[model samples]
Target: MEAESGKHIQKAEGTKLEQSSFEPSALSFQLKIGFDGKRAANNLTGLGNYSRSLIEHLAHQFPENQYLVYSPKVKSSKQIDAFFKLKNIELKLPLNGRFLWRSLNILKDLSRDEVKIYHGLSHEIPFAIQHTRIKSVVTIHDLIFLRFPRYFKYIDRKLYLLKSRYACKHANKIIAISEKTKADIVEFYKIDPDKIQVIYQSCDDSFKMPFNKETLSRIRATYKLPEKYILNVGTIEERKNLKLIVQALKEVNEAYKLVVIGKQTKYFKTVEKEIEKLGLKNRILFLKNIPFSDLPGIYQMASVFAYPSFYEGFGIPIIEALYSNVPVVAATGSCLEEAGGPDSLYVSPTDSTGLAAAINQILSSEQQQARMKKKGLEFVQKFNNPLVTQQLMDSYKALLNTANY
Candidate 1:
């Protein structure tokens, strides 16, 4: 699967000029790079993890370059604290009118900082970036609101479309987290496929590290986790399809329970009703506000990881589960196959029986579990920190090396 996806990624990148090997020392001078740091400082989920992980790895791999993280305000946490500890990274905050500064006024600061390249870690870049000397890049994580319009409010969809379309039209480069997202960008916004690059995301180092049995046991007791259970990690929402798992639990063995860890939305109430309808109130566990430090341990201790989300740009938890050495079973119809690789099991998002069978197959056979764990870990190394960071840096270098820039 790694080789197969590599061919697709290589083809996606073939449109770019100067497809040369990238080495930090080959450059004659240092570069100044800036990022839209809103999610890195404030968001703790998908976008935030993407921002922090990319910035951290870039700074580590190329310490000669300076990374400027610009945001309106920052919320302090252990993750943010560790991020600031990197010597090459500096955080920039607005003077006043926080929203206005990030949108329209930030170009003035970029000129003063001599930022050679500015990357929007989420779905937006500052307005009027094209008029300035800075080369801009924006990562469109997913078009979920556009793809599943029923899940979002009318006004929110309008706002998202406005910002995303403007960014796609104006930015020098567009980064899509998965090929699925890249295809969506071209289809929905009518952008040229050559203008976009598909770069996969990597999970945090915490998930890749080994934990002692005592640590795993402590986390198990802390969460009161079942001895054998299927783990699902993500927000509890309709698109996440938690209820499908609830319905599948009826077919799974009674000895195995379902553990969920995420924030709840109104859709959670609907899931609770399904649990009641199926008499699974006691068989399911919903955990919220779990600390980041304990998540890897929780993943390592689970019997199997299940993600039946109807759609996603790329499923980070699937890779996180793979890194934790847990077998993964995720829903089809999106980029999950790319994330989980070929060895991992996949089922239709709406097929509860198939999901149950896949879950039970792993739980019942130790040999099957071992084979998946080995192949999954080997396949996921393609998204390791060095490789992913270098791919991103190559994009930046390509933009800077362009004749127009």
Candidate 2:
């Protein structure tokens, strides 16, 4: 049956493909959609940002449709607060079983609410959702845990594999954030390619907007940022390969400092030990608890942005930096090429000298920076909010239109 489904598969480059236009006015009625809201409401990292941004854009673009976000609890943050203020979005919580509701019992509430489409914003959907009338869609962000097993605990890898395989097998449709992820799903889980749709995600709207010099200066003063620095963002973890950037700083110009912003993990000690060995304590600055609003200014003021992650489902920071008009130097082994586009420079993840050369190549030449900035801005427009939201809404409508459903 899965092989039969592969017959309808179409080739996709990143998220670009022929898609039917989404017109809310042409629709007979409004859509009542449900999403896995745990990350949207609580997580402060990549998954959370993806969830919040997608939901916000969908709401803004399709106000007539009803959005139901289900989560066990909500945390108060500037982003979350702003999300709640938007019209046409409602937060749903279980009356009880808050602990296991999402995994074990959320389907009951989904059925009761008559959610026409249920999207698991993260990987897994509730078990037995295939038996329900609600058409199910699951977004498989990445198979990083499977790709880089050494970075994760043995049990964690097993659990991730189990849940992801189950989701791919059961969900009526799958949304792959990148073409690479779509390929990984087919390769690892043996799922039908036709079952997956590539839909790129956009960064926060704040990154796309311009910040004035005064506002940038205020952010610089607040963070005590250096006059010139290279920026790297994402959780400081083994797979993120922050250590590579730390090593490359040895070869980069002494005048340019490296600013690291992220939630640190045990792997940070490994990077710190390398920093101590290299005697770069004064050359590196690590910032924590940065407000989301201030991130754009930080990126805008940077000399260059560096991301040497060993692997990713999709690299959001590359687009964020591109939108901020900063040239990017990202690692080459994974899907960074797709996110960075052809204009951004790439180096091997383990090549410290090459990475440093790429960074310096951008910083030392104004002409090079301007060209990359121009081309990157042009490439990133394909991931804009309206186009991405339309693709998503069209996916939902297409799923509902299927006669089998």
Candidate 3:
């Protein structure tokens, strides 16, 4: 009796499949989404943060979509670039060794395996994969290489410009983190404006809530933070405009120290030398690679968070600072205004005096700080988890509509 019932169910399912116009995939799924996992589970920066958040969001939101993470392969065409190394790389990711192996060789396998959508989490797309069945989508974080080439090495800038130009030209769709970035891509690459979509980046979930006083004290002790210090946290690269931030600190009262949280690259020494020249050695502290968990407390302890970077795709740190209720004095131009919205005190990135004056105003006026704190929280509220995740899903759906997934 059981054998007869099983045969009946099988016969019915076969009939349905025969009648239906769409057939189930030869594999378990219809679509495959690929991410450039070059930085995943290793040292987490803005790109890593963006990658990790989006991966988790995608996995949770659309469980049916089969996702493939494309990382670098170890053996072929590998040049160990020291500039990419961070101390935390070994702490978590076991797949770090296999990365170069995948990027060089296994990318070709995507076509063999029938991947439908390939998304470059960073600006780069594997040049070898263009002939494959996979449709490419590239996210252009910024055109800073074109806009501020002087801040980068000549060769590095040229390489980024070339690669990004190719990616923009070839990809099926382009994702821009801000409107300013989309505009820059259009002007520089001369791509069709209709091909790009402006999607804002969301702050990390860890920054959403406040930190405890004990944790703040521990972070202060661990980093040896100065009493009553101001904070600036991001990469200590030249494009961050640290020279002006250091110069601006000179005009403020001696009670406040300018605390920077990021590592030093070669070009960053220019800012360090200026700090010494201005007799600010004792007043400015550089702390690199703080754990992300502790940054919220560090931000909370900050009298104000001053970020006067000349360029950005979208200022995630500004959103993080605001979420922690830290008053912000961020630069006005580019996407800083978009990220900080109306809540931040926008100073011209090149004007040290403007930055200093803005800081002084925020520091001296308690009412202004209070108002900014309130407004900052409110500003960040719109950029919460659901909205950003939903926006990205909508973009993916739109791309599918335009192209065969």
lDDT per residue, candidate 2, 210-320, as tens digits?
999899999999999999999999999988999999999999999999999999999999999999999999999999889887999999999899999999999999999
In terms of lDDT, model 3 sits at 0.73
lDDT of 3 at 358: 92
lDDT of 1 at 315: 92
Ranking by TM-score: 1, 2, 3
Model 3, span 1-405: residue lDDT tens: 011110111111111011222222333554567677665533356676687577656655554565555543211111112211211111111232444443345555566446677788778777766676667788999988789877777999988887789899988789999999999999999999999988788876778877777887898899898879899998888778889989999999789999998878876879879988999999988887676668788888899999999889888899889898999999877888888878788988899999999999999989999999998899888788778878887787787787654
Clashes in each model (backbone N, CA, C under 3 Å)? 0, 0, 9
lDDT of 1 by residue, 45-67 (tens): 77887898899788888777878
Better of 1 and 3 by lDDT: 1
Best by TM-score: 1
TM-score of each: 0.91, 0.91, 0.82
Weakest ten-residue segment in model 2 by summed lDDT: 1-10
Error of 3 at 172 (Å): 1.1
